[model samples]
Target: MRKIWDIHGGIHPEENKHQSTGTAIGSIPLPPEIILPLNQHIGAPAEACVSVGDKVLKGQLVAKAQGLFSAGIHASTSGEVIAIEDRVVTHPSGMSAQCIIIKPDGEDRWTQLDACEDYAQLDHDRLVQKIRAAGIVGMGGAGFPTAIKVNPKSNKHVKTLIFNGTECEPYITADDMLMRERADDIVKGVQLIARFMGEVEETLIGIEDNKPEAIAAMQKAAEGTDIEVVVFPTKYPSGGEKQLIQILTGKEVPSGGLPADIGIVVQNVGTALAAYRAVRFGEPLISRVTTVVGETLTTQRNIDVLIGTPLSFVLEQHGFKAEKKQRLIIGGPMMGFAANDFDVPVVKTTNCILAPTQKELPLAPPAQACIRCGMCAEACPASLLPQQLFWYSQAEDHDRLKAHNLFDCIECGACSYVCPSNIPLVQYYRASKGAIKIANAEREKSDKARVRFEFRQERIAKAEAEKEAKRLARKKAAEEAKKLLAEKADSPAAANEKTTSKPGAAAAKPQAADPATQKAKLERALSSAQSRVERAQKALNDEQEEADEARLDSLRARLKQAELKASEAQAKLDEFGKAPEVTVGGEQAIKDKMAMSPRDKLEKNLASLNKRLSTAQERLAEAQANGAATVDALKMGVEKLQQKVNDAEQELAQLGPDSAAQGAAETAPALSAAEQAIEKAKAKAAAQASMSEEEKAAAKLEALKARLEKARARLTKAEEEQDENIDAFRAGVEKLEQKLTELSN
Candidate 1:
């Protein structure tokens, strides 16, 4: 039994093709001006080789190819480029791209160019270069760079060349007519490609049976060349490159990969004609055959149009008929965009300007929910689960939609056509895909900011804590050292009394008693001082190390900060000690804890106390500083010092200080000058307390201004990228102002 295969596809959408293909080819007169878009292919836009004031000739290379993947632009007729700026393009985005506006002289003069013979003699790389320079791109719907299709340096296994003469698309017969008229040129172009493939195995030209005339013409054209022209059964999208390749070679291209991966290369019939021009005439691809067909047009012809010609002009030339008009489609009604505006340009891939009226092709009604009917699934050529994707996409469940292979759906509009629900399936899929992309971008940016900000804040906090611990240990060592010295000096005074007792003086007492007391005190004092120094050593070891690079760098920064702070703190400390107490009649100096934050005011007081202690130690430098003052002097100053210290200690204890007290003492040098007062505060503490409220308010204002400035800058950047956030900016500012007012109140 012979095997029969039929791939899943849509119902027969109305062709309405008779209006254009029924008539023979007719000539279109040149317009006064022809607009040329710099980009007509699916790669980098061509760079303008001709300036605004420069003149050009018919079929002259006007724009240089931009990149290896880019196509070149040319002048279709001798003209002057009056402007090079944004003009409408037949882009799915419906947005304008850069274009060159030409005012043609209508004489259509040909530029002097080098036409080559024996193209096989040229280097393969050079051939590809010429093709790229000539601006030849895939003319079959997709305007991919044609040079890219042939140069499969990456994949050397492609052994077969397939020529596509299968114009299976409904209502468009441009390729069919071209094959009928230029079959010999098309075959010659194929041989030129065969020159590169080098002794190619077998060349195959596939056409659908519906185009018997094209197949007959190609059969004669390829008569003795070993190129086999086969006719396959008629089918929609048989003209599709991958689809036609499968029908001819029985090869199914793996998803997301190309035909080259499977040892095959496909070229369209019209593309072959362009190749012949590139090789034989040295002419670039500047014009294309546009099928003007529909009930709306007064006259329909396969007009050769210059690229970037406005759709409006094309429609006007034929006389627009609005009678019973429903929609204006750019390509065939099966898979094409309905024209929202008439300013779109004719690009390299534009095959037809299909204007089927309501009577010709009626618009469907409002979409109804899917009833789980599988007509859409059956119609899907890629074998996707359309209904499943539709469900997730409508619910905005992006992950599920992707998991169901939504990307594979090709937006052919077939699923919607057979859909009993009349669902606009493609629209939902497009919206979901766009939303998913935008969401991913936002998430990535947010994650990056969070990581950087958190790490910075953590580093700052850890550094401050490490510096504080070292300072406390140093202060404790100083206090203990002072106590040991006092104890050493006081022992001498007591020992003297023991030696002078009258009853036992004669027998027990000796002149050595004073020296013995002095020795005991010296020994004890030396031991205590050594212990103090040892403790300091242990603390210094634990505080920070030179080996931990990050920690060391942080400490060096903190030390500089501490040094800066010490200068300011010393000044205030000196002032406090020097200023005499004011004589208010029987009123003790009141330092109410509530009047100011312990963190600042307390630091000022602590600095003053430390300064007093430092000054007292200087006088006793010979004893405490040098460990050698006389016993009596050491005892006198220390005994009195301990009593005054006890009273000052009592005041600190009564403050009921918490962790803030240690922090206050820590901030003695780090703290800046005391703030004066808050503009508004509670009456009881208003006079003494100072607040950073005014400065904070000013800072907030500046921050808002900076945010606005940055938003403006971001908006400018967004405009360049074709993604603006002006509405988002305005909404956020409104929310910010509301929050600020609530906080202020």
Candidate 2:
């Protein structure tokens, strides 16, 4: 049944496993200086918690975890930090990442790590916390956070736990040695994780049929336990999570579904050892056993190395002649990236560093055009139409590539191996995948900006509607007031009554007589002007705050320097033979080695600092000169603000006691001014209507939509072509899929 269940499509190239598997893993002596990368794991690189000159103890976390996905970085040896800057990292891209360089102080001091024999007694969350705090991460090639993966999501109801011991990739033996040496520890760790996974109905440790010794050792360890040891056929990528699960349980982890979705969880054997060390010894995953081997090396053996230790160091230790090796790789030939720079540090996921000579791993020559051979389609493990993907990618048809499931290509290099043209198919696929990801990110950013734009547009429309409603209400109120006044005067009864009642008074003597009412109008005007002045003052305060924050960075740097100087003086007096300065001023002398020359006092001061960093060391005389100039600038700015405040106060004081009445009288004129201002604002808004950013975007979108319609029509016409060629293509596809399936099986 399992034989029948093996999914089709793969290539079986020469298995070059003997180059590095002969010897067991042994620890390497630590180098005088170790450069530890903060971002050794898969997630967000850990943030640097310590500075360039801080003294760190072994096992102490030098860099704290940046996020839930990030892992903490521990010091491999008690050392003074030499530098924290860009260095060669273990990335396949060979780019520089942040690294913490530590110079061992010869003490080999430890931070007193916590160990527990009764680790199982601890609460599950506490165990996960301990794992995280200890900086434990997956030692498998994946380098995912181990604590994150240990849990079998309850929603998925994981029923089977598969311990993946299938080190099927040729020329790597890190996991195989670990299993052979510490089967019991791995078994224990497996049980610990199994408990975390809740009820595990079945636990299977799947090792390849080739390693009978490893299988025997694990089987012995699982004697009384429910853990089952299963042997699988020797096949390339049989160790892949999906392929392994299928081999053992005949369960497929549907196209996008994880192991948990199929009630199964798979973990690497190397990860099992890491789990044991972390849980039993309370040790973080600082070092991992890496297979450094190939025919070009002076010696081939697995070395246990600290994460972020440079590959050059490992090669030098093994007597490898770097110049002689034609090719260097970070993992198996099937899946690893080429290493042009040997200085790349060992990352958490780095399992093997293969230094192969031309004879061992020969480079293929330039490729010619495909002869419609269909061999690549036959070799694809994902059962994808590699030929179709190649066509889309070649034509730069991103949409077509996506339709062909370009993302599903895991970049195993099987297609490249089988192609007669010797094309670097995987490189093309990788470039396409990278392009697609970047496009996706750009689309997401554009979507966010569009959402913000839409919100702004909606708010503007709402505010305009409200403003129009307010204007109509004011117009209606004014009309009503005028109507009431007209009715009172026009009524015959009102006129007759008023005339009859005015017998005592002269006909021309009708007038208003209240001085206080006039005074009230002037005060209201003064208050409005005062409010405007206050608004101006608040704006000035905001600008001042911005100025202060901008100065904060330089101020903080000075503060750090001062603190280091004070600590240095104390350290010198406390000890007879004082420690050598780790920093000179605040700069790390990574590029310079100290010797022969008479060290200046500033250099001595810089050496003793803990995280004391400096941009550039300027002479004291220059600093004094700069200080004097800065003082003058500050004086001028103060004088300017004071003058402005004084002018504002004087303007307010000029308005006398009759200011209130004067302001009241000016209210009618103020209303007229406000009406004029509103008219100007409305005219400006009308003028901007066609020139607004929203208007421009709308036009662009319309143009794009038209182009899209045209493209869609062309695509439809192209698709109709399939009917003519499809029968032959389908037959070609079936034959190709069959060949690939045959090779895979």
Candidate 3:
């Protein structure tokens, strides 16, 4: 006999478990359809791997775990995925959730499985993955992913691995019958879990003394090993993870903490068997032994029910009667919720299909005012004052509810079971807990919003300060320029001094030319200025299309500068009015200079063609080197430019130009560099969209390297006090480096 520690509060409910334990475990026939909910466990829903109308073999993965806390889901039998849509699921909220519906083929075929006799030789990570792949969860009640549960935090080492075989809930014998039939498998799973935990010191199996057969079976199976089967007295709600831990180890798990926090890990016996099948036989959790017991059913026994089987079908198999006002509970009466609709399918957390008649388990009388009785408090397993919590919960006094440790209540219904007023105490606590959780989440969101707003304000303030500093600096520069101009204007000697102080100013001065030559140069410069102004006006006045404002402005500015130079030249020539004959000859000279020979025109055109060809060739090479999609277009552009260059050279030769002048011939239309860059970008995007995974990864790696270099430059600048937000800049550098390392690995 093992010493069983007494918990704070408990009740001795009628043990109706024997009704379902008299016979051997039965097998369930395949239902017409199964509805597998994506979120059968306690975390994020698993992602569906199969689509509608796909044929899937039994035990094939239908959905994969979404994240670290989710479990995989496999098909219960060979079937076609008829639909993937929202359906009724086993949740207390009575809401429809995403589920996969399958139509069985009656073949009972299985997918290829990989069994391992040498699982112990596998590394720890491999074992965890195997368990996760098998979809093992805490079958006792919580339905937490077992793989994550078995893995304690890095700082904590598992010492005691307790198997909860104490099926203390009323009218639930699923675990008991499972132990009696498959004790060896359960024991093997226990050993596997210990091995996974790096050799847990104590492997204890806790079973109620009322389950003599189960205890004996486990003890026999665990023989010749270090596993211990601890038998204690039968007590209602004794199978809770925390309660069992205290009973077996005389240690209490701190409030709102896990047994793992105290170096103890608990796994339900059914979960252990599932782990055994997964590790040894490579069978996933496609089926479970569910206890179907109630007066509404003709048969009351445990059956190996396939997961996702409809509750109505299972009840019909047991000769269920359809009544207008019948109760169908999904678990033990104490902690189970009423299922008004029978369309919901069985899920991983379902332990019992209890359909007790109103007579077998009658409804409680309506509640009366509390007489300030301490009876509810005395029955609270967590030692909480239920009366206080209930009043505060109704009043919506969340602070008082939390102060009274309302979250620690497991809602086992022990208080309601013994309540004289028949108050639904558990319901109040559940609602209060939900309210508190919502309030806390809203508070967290508000805090995050506040931080973002403050950060944005700070950024705005910094930007305004920088803008003001730049404005002040520009004003100071203008003031200094104005001061120099005023000093020169105040004195003629100061202006002369400034000019003489300039480097090479005296050396750059030129002697005056003869009057004939000077007059000719001035007239030629004036003609050139007039030609520029006419060209600028023609470009601006073109009506075939909209003129570019920036281009027109640039031309106008150039024409103004040319006119200013021509005016200065004319002024210098006016000083030599003694040359009247030169003025008449200068007009003829202007016409001769403006009209170029055909060979000269051809040479100039060829030079432009060569420049375009060279630019196109450079672009093509760059595109090819970067593996850009613009390669083909750039290559075509280069070929076209090259052909133009060749044609220009031939034309120059035809014009009777010398061989040395054949390089220039005809002008070619060319795309601006900005337009070329835009095309390159579009082509690159198209190429990236068509790339394979590996190619995409390579491109991403290159991009990350470039970004990393930029980040490093920014970090260096920040270090040199060139910018603020040094911490953010440093973090960006580190983040880029981390991404690079991951990609490299």
Candidate 4:
């Protein structure tokens, strides 16, 4: 016999085990349908692998485990899948989960099995995989995956493997009945787990003194083996994992820790039997022994119920008296919850379905205020301050509740049982635990959001700094180029070149007198002036329509100037004549102009327009900086010059590439500003024309990305200022984003 250690607090309620133990473990007839919930255990819910209308076999893997902590779900009987949708499941809250409903065909067919003649021949990893595939969980009610408990980390050596057969709860006798009948199978499972654990020090089966028949059967089965069947004084809640560990090995698991941490592993006796069947016979956990007991039933005993069998169906098998039943609860009364619906199906974790009469298990009286009687404190199995935790829970003070070790409370209802005030102390602790978890999750989410926001701000700031650096670098380069130009212009070689080229430059000016060339220039001037006039007139009309006096006066003045320019351009065109034929007197002049070539003429024209644009832009900037009245007129003049420059460059581009090369070589030594601008424009056009469609798309995508960044910046500024055009800026940003996405794709 092993010396047993007792826990701090416990209370023995009425032992209602005799009602279920009178009869042996029995099986119910196959129901018409079985409803299997994907999530019958803790951790992530299993994902269904079967669809409605699919034929499935008994022990078929209908759902696969989602992760390591979860367990797979198997069909209980050979059937056709009828439905796969949300249905009421066996839960404390009576919640609905994804279920696979099957209609039995009465055949009880099974898929091929890979049974092992001897589990000892398999390796540790193979054994664990086999157990995991079996879908076995802690049938003792915690529903923790059995594979995870048996297989600890390599460094954490397990010394003891204890089987829990205490069944200390009020009316649960599923394990008790299983032990009395299937003792040898349970011992075999214990040996298999011990082998999986490498070299466990001792194997012990912990039972309470109240279960004498179970103790004797387990001892007889454990004979000639190192496994020990240890019995101790019966106490309420001793079946708890931690409590059982303490009672069997005198070792207490650390708070918020597991038995594996203390070199020990505990598994429910039912789980052992399930594992044994799974490994030895290649059977999945399709059914479990469940105690059906209560005064509201005509018959009360343990039933080998198929997983997913509806509670209503099971109750009908035993002649349940609905009118006499006060409440329907799953598990034992100490830790069970009232089931709201009879349609809820039983799961692997359901040990007992308790339906009691009003007189047999009457509802608790209405809760009264706490009286500080100290009885609850004495009866707390976890040695926690129930009164303090209850107070903090009522106040919704999560920090204080955590400080009082509220999570350590096993919610055994011992404190509530001893309370004179009838306060549901355990309910308060459960609610507080839920509240604290939610609060912690929300706080963690907030922290992540804060981190992301800070990271975005830093990225934006870095981009801005880089942009500023590039601008300064470009400014410096331009200043250096200007300084070099000035120095070259003052050099003797430049002076000699300029002096020598003056006559040719002067000679080239006379070509402007040619009738054909002069007429074309005047026509172009007229077209540009008319375009400016239209733009200014439109601006004035828009202002007038809006009745905005501030911009109307400036717009009118700009329109008047544009009209004057247009009139002068028309007069020049009329004076020059529109006829295509030139007079004999100007025939020599046309010949001289023709010698310069059309490409040279267009290039020179582009150079002149570029100079004029540069001057106009400078004047506009100065006027705007000084807040001058001519700011609007200067801006209009700059726009017109830019348009003329673009037109000249386009005409130059129309000339053949050979002509462009010839022109570039002729003006290579001392390139003018307009010549340089023409060269750049021509090169750009040639590059674009040479590019493939994909290359062009890539370039456009890059430009769109840049535009989107600038637009987003503007939108941010507008939003910060609460500007009236904030919506317009936001729309612009979205448009740019859409374009970018399309181009990227």
Query: Which candidate comes out best when scored by lDDT?
Result: 4
Which parts of model 2 have CA positions greater than 4 angstroms off?
1-5, 465-510, 513-745
lDDT of 2 by residue, 1-745 (tens): 1242465576566776666667777777777678888778778999888988899988888888988888898988888999998987776677888899988888878888788899879888877877788777766677778777775455878889988998878888888877878899899889888887787899888888888778888989999998888886687777777877878888777675677887888888777777778888888777888888887788887888877677888888888886778888999888898888877777778899888889888889999998889888877767888888888888889999988878777787888888899988888888888888899999999999999779767866875676576557656655765576688668997689777775667575343322333233333333333333333333344344444765554454343333333333322333322324333442334222221121232234334331122211222234456773223223323343454445444444454344554555444333334565797799877866857787755665565555555445444544574333345555554555554455435
For 467-577, candidate 1 gives per-residue lDDT tens digits of: 566556555655666676668657877679766778744564233323334444444444444443444333334446424766555554444333333323433344444
Compute each candidate's TM-score over C-alphas. 0.59, 0.67, 0.69, 0.69
Off by over 4 Å in 3: 452-745
Candidate 3 per-residue C-alpha lDDT over 269-365 given as tens digits, one digit per residue, 9 for 90 to 100 = 9999999899888999999999999988889999999999999999999988766225899899999999978989999889999988878888888
Clashing pairs in 4: 607-674
The predicted structure with the larger TM-score, 2 or 4, is: 4
Span of ten consecutive residues with least summed lDDT in model 1:
671-680
Clashes of each: 0, 15, 2, 1
**What lDDT score belongs to each candidate, Candidate 1 first?**
0.71, 0.72, 0.83, 0.85
Runs in model 1 deviating more than 4 A are: 1-5, 198-200, 432-745
Comparing candidate 2 with candidate 3, which one achieves the higher TM-score?
Answer: 3
